[model samples]
Target chain A: MTTSIHTLDTPVAVVDVARMNRNIQRMQQRADSLGVRLRPHVKTTKCAQVVEAQIQAGAQGVTVSTLKEAQAFFTQGVTDILYAVAMAPNKLAHALDLRRAGCALIIVTDSVAGARAIVEFGRAHDERFEVFIEIDSDHHRSGVRSDDPLLGDIAKMIHEGGAVLKGVMTHAGESYKLNTLEALQEIAELERSECVKAAEAIRAAGIPCPEVSVGSTPTALSAVHLEGVTELRAGVYVFFDLVMHNVGVCALDDLALSVLTTVIGHQPDKGWIITDSGWMAMSRDRGTQAQQCDFGYGLVCDSNGTLIDGLLLRSANQEHGVASFEEGMSVDVEKLYPIGTQLRVLPNHACATGAQYPAYEALQPNGEMAHWSRVNGW
Target chain B: MTTSIHTLDTPVAVVDVARMNRNIQRMQQRADSLGVRLRPHVKTTKCAQVVEAQIQAGAQGVTVSTLKEAQAFFTQGVTDILYAVAMAPNKLAHALDLRRAGCALIIVTDSVAGARAIVEFGRAHDERFEVFIEIDSDHHRSGVRSDDPLLGDIAKMIHEGGAVLKGVMTHAGESYKLNTLEALQEIAELERSECVKAAEAIRAAGIPCPEVSVGSTPTALSAVHLEGVTELRAGVYVFFDLVMHNVGVCALDDLALSVLTTVIGHQPDKGWIITDSGWMAMSRDRGTQAQQCDFGYGLVCDSNGTLIDGLLLRSANQEHGVASFEEGMSVDVEKLYPIGTQLRVLPNHACATGAQYPAYEALQPNGEMAHWSRVNGW
Candidate 1:
């Protein structure tokens, strides 16, 4: 009773169920052995089913980029969630609603104004909230520097304003810029040490800090030590994209999701084969920019899911993709993919491509199909 | 009354009504005097409100890239639609549903299997579908070359089947690759002439050839003459992006939509200001590959929607963006944007970024906000 292309709609997302389970279990086992609580980020899939899988595989908490995700998952019985993004004043009500719904909501902030806004919102709603002062570990993206004087001030404000200080959190976002695993490991250590130091600073300021969170898909997965970190929040591990593979975080086989498309035309003279999948199908995520290897939009695969070596989607439009094989790479396009023949395309960034589609067609080990819905919007 | 940030949720999308209406009228008026049918592609906005505005502005029909989009717009009273992508077997039933609901669908196909599949589906469903044989114009993406010997044969097969032949169509997708407007105009003329030749071949083979549709936002806008193109199907003109401006299609001021975000933190030493807008908010669309100028992720704007000269979002993580100004291009990060201050970011690709959020907060000329939902998923 294997489900084939005839049973599903074109342009629908499909996840290899066995591979997905493996990805979840592998990360959970690593986190468990490292003595750190695993809080797998749900922003990758935005699907309750995927989140449930992670929870069943031993994720103690879930990380979300938006308050909408927190509210949606809270309604679905996921009580512990880390709203990983800086909360805006507009989203305060939604956060309060999640807190009222018995959610162990954790919010991150680095600015004095952000701290004040959250504090004011908590007072107005008369709700006690958990807060973490974000530390900038690598000067890559957001957060106050680990040694910034403002860190202690923000911690004091959060403590005095009736909010529970939940230690500190930081992301080694620059870890993705590393070209070698050694560089990534160095970044991981730096992130852990900085977070511990930031927590120590808050403790010295008379704030009771309980948990220190650190995350980055590359750094978290490859970190050899978790001496100070109490929790790990890494998304994109469950669905490894081209960017992850290029950074040596995961292998090609570890990627659990892909966009299934069909060959629509061919230009043999120009050595171009057209597929129905375009940027809209795979997303405009050029995660290969920093990678050692550039896999155009994504790694092309044959109908049976075998990686088509040297073939890449060289160009794309809104609804059409042009694939070109590397020089001297030869394959019988007409025989392997007669017009209308179906094939799968691995994404450059799973989170972006996966978000473009509405639902996932879960393919079991034996090829049976089970549909799962994904959440979108704010 | 003006809409307050407190009334809207974080991560929700917003559209400027005045700018959008102006964009609609400008394109409509341009196409009207050109004596070509203005068939606005709905893929850019995908909002019913935006589609209604296009229709009210004298757009004769709508263009969509997927069967799901076709069904959505059809249900919304858009009776005429051109499903711009190659129609696959999986989408045939959905296309038939739209036709059964009394919607006129113009689908595109270039191969024999595609033609056969559509014909078979039409016969099985006891319905007739209108189709256009897609022709390659500049080897940009999909479609058979106009000079391909099989072009006439594919047209004959469709004409012999129960489906109605609606001439041929082509898109100069490569027009975006041009470095100058002269190149764009050349590509446009090439696309229009190629499509006309393909339609002529179909008519010579005794098929009814009524319309030769050619489109590409860059080409359509800069084209001096569209003599052979009976109908134009450009979409991105409604919301010009950095890609459009780079390709000489539209100016930066012509971009009608932007991602609204709030400043969260700053690193004074590094001159880095972080915002809530990241790849998730602006989309990971690097439209600068073909453009002469690279705007990093997108053009930065101030709280009042004014473009911040010399400042661009140099880097982004999944949930955080860091803006960098050119050397010596001084700007007040603290005075202009205190923490929690709102700002807007123009996108690199309008269609890709617009698809990230689920709805648009339609802002009236007076700054009053109204909710307009956009359809997503397959």
Candidate 2:
């Protein structure tokens, strides 16, 4: 844990420790002031060390994207966990195992058929599976419409089928596409209200709905207030990336994650300084492509983590990234960025880029480093 | 190895063993009939088992995109390794260790500065390292132009620096952009002839040019003859993807890898069948976006490996994928693909998609599975 950051290998994922702590504190304060518990989504890092820090910073429970994550965190002694993604019937046994092992794991469903499968599996196993209904707040991705008659119907089905009907949840993923503050705030309000409305319907139908959750990094940061929401869940806010920067949620300096790379070669005439951080290192997520500013692959930075204006990682092959300036081949690249020079690239999306590496080199404020392992796959 | 593939976890990567071996033999026969050695690029799979199979099928040596691959394969007794990407000066120590361990690790360079660094390091270590001068035949990526005056300059520098000058190499990455057989064949010839021309220039300057290596999956498959070339190196052909299919080189059935997933839920009105194979499992590789036919994230298929006529994985979140018809949501998704139903999705790019999984489930001909571990990161 005491290795120097600069001594690490190129293409290593580095997390700025100071920035990460600040991000965690900012979100925890926001949730506390809004009177909602922050159930930070552990899917962002999937590292026990990072989640431990979140829990220490006042996160009540954890939100997971898969059963594997729930199992992983539960092994780390985290009891309360919510698997955010809609449950697949085939994964029922894995969920049951975690619950039986003393982990309060909650699964979700968005359709009547999905609920039926869960109920059938729960009854067959003679286990009371806690379930949540997913609501469509912005019509961005998979979720049931808040007003759908099936929302209450699925709740009643779960209650009558010997399973625990927990609550309703939704993610305002479409809020990412909006640039204006007003639009983001409106979507945030919608995400909170719709999820609350879904919970109310279930309770009115004589079903016990104990929780109502809503989040997305953008919506969580822009929400005016969570009047009826009981808990907030947001991933990627702990390590804000270029996508969040473009959305006006975080400043460029607030980006905690970057890929440390080495300048290998250069195409002088073409003004390209090829680095070892390519798509494999930075990931193939072009999240900033549709924003007001499009960082081709990512924004380029100096070895000291200072943003280099005009210079950008324009294109990438599997193991090579081409760094070029917007003004064209104006400088002597070989002279300016000689071979072996170290550089860091700010990624477009933190979650995608972090998944590319097995372990993260967390650069502490004292210049020391901690190697934190990251889990991958389902 | 005797376990049935159907019993494996959902979202696991499955490599059809029969199809992979057929791909290996097809490429090997092509290279042998053309009077060239086949040096399979292990970067495609990064699996020792897959590379061993290639060598068993007559591949002479291995091509790698990173020193990590060289180290991994070398530890497995594969001494002949080519670190194909332009070597970064900082990796000199690691390369030296590989060489000292009796590995014939060949490094590459495209510029005078890059050559100088290699020479300086070689002399410092008192080792006559073998070096390859990369030639830019297609102007697509890193290399000194085939006709650039620097070709002879770097070659002379490498030869005089107490190092072994191995000769020239190039990758026709632009070949993937072509769709017609004629265009692909023409680019393949150009890739070969231009690389040969670069080697001729080095030799014309009184330097020995023993090898002329050129390849890319599309170029290697389309080249009519490699008259002046000694070796061909191609990755991704062992597991053809939608990108290669759109490039008109591989048939749909030629694809050897797929993500096996289960239908989790559905939005009956939107006709969306949600699956656990999201970007995390399928990878965020939209490589076919600009191709002749765009397959969103991937093409949908039945559990038995037959292509679904109109179904396509239209979009992906972190832990979920939305499958719908290309024309429109015309079918009752809940009935057609009920919850817990198994499905397969062919990826857009084999290399990117394969990088997402921790291990690949090799599906043998008899429907049994062999879990093959895949190497990741530098």
DockQ, all models:
0.66, 0.83
lDDT comparing candidate 2 with the true structure:
0.91
**List of clashing residue pairs for candidate 2:** none
Error of 1 at A333 (Å): 1.4
List candidate 1 stretches off by more than 4 Å. A1-6, B1-6, B123-126
Q: Compute the lDDT of residue B339 as modeled in candidate 2.
A: 86
lDDT against the true structure, each candidate: 0.83, 0.91
Q: Choose the strongest candidate by TM-score.
A: 2
Q: Residue-wise lDDT of candidate 2 within A1-378, one digit each (tens)?
A: 687767788989999989999999999999999899999998889898899999999999999987888988999999999999888877889999999999999999888888898999888999999988899999888888879888878888889988898888999999888888999999999999999988888888888899999998899989999988999999999999999999999999999999999999988888889999999999999999989999988998987799988889999989999999888437888898998889999999999999999989999888888999987777
Per-residue lDDT of candidate 2, residues B94-212 (tens digit)? 99999999999999999888889999999999988899999899889899987888888899899998888998999999998999999999999999999999989888999998999
Candidate 1, residues B37-112: lDDT per residue as tens digits?
A: 9998889988888999899999998999777788888888888899888887767777777787799988888887
| Least well predicted 10-residue stretch by lDDT in candidate 2 chain B | B326-335
